[model samples]
Target: MRTAAELKYGEKGIINDIDGSHPSSRRILEVGFTPGQEIQLINMSAFRDPIAFSVRGTIIAIRKDEASCIKVL
Candidate 1:
């Protein structure tokens, strides 16, 4: 498994798991970052701290730190 943070821009993957104990995990889940969901790295900010993604029919942005806790296949 690889982390969502490792996905390059425009890359796509299926969510395998998320480290639920992480502080922001609940908010991530609430935004539809769940297992078996398809996610695509849509874009990144100029500094790349917040990365945009297309997931579960919506577009959301998350920081690299939070993205690291999400595992993908």
Candidate 2:
């Protein structure tokens, strides 16, 4: 039940689900973070507010708040 935000740098995870009620859920999905997708933490900002993830052949940067809504394992 861990969230994407909880994944350590360079760790990989499978997307379990994204909170449908979250405002950024749609945007997240559009970026290829759909359920069952494989994702990896690629980078993080200096303050760790925004984190970069590798998924579906591309890198995506999302705020920590929005990332927390994405459950992973």
lDDT of 1 by residue, 14-72 (tens): 99999988899999999999999999999899998799889988899999999998999
Residue-pair clashes, model 2:
0
Worst 10 residues of 1 by lDDT: 48-57
Residue 18 deviation, candidate 2, in Å?
0.9
Give the Cα error of residue 68 in candidate 1, in Å: 0.7
In the order shown, what is each candidate's alpha-carbon RMSD?
A: 0.7, 0.6
How many residue pairs clash per model?
0, 0
Provide TM-scores for the models. Answer: 0.95, 0.96
Cα deviation of 46, candidate 1, in Å: 0.3
Q: After superposition, how far is residue 64 of candidate 1 from its true place, in Å?
A: 0.3
Task: Give all candidates' CA lDDT scores.
Answer: 0.94, 0.94
- Candidate 2 lDDT tens digits, 1-73: 9999999999999999999999999999998999999999999999987999999999999998999999998
Instruction: Give the runs in model 2 whose Cα sits over 4 Å from its true position.
Output: none
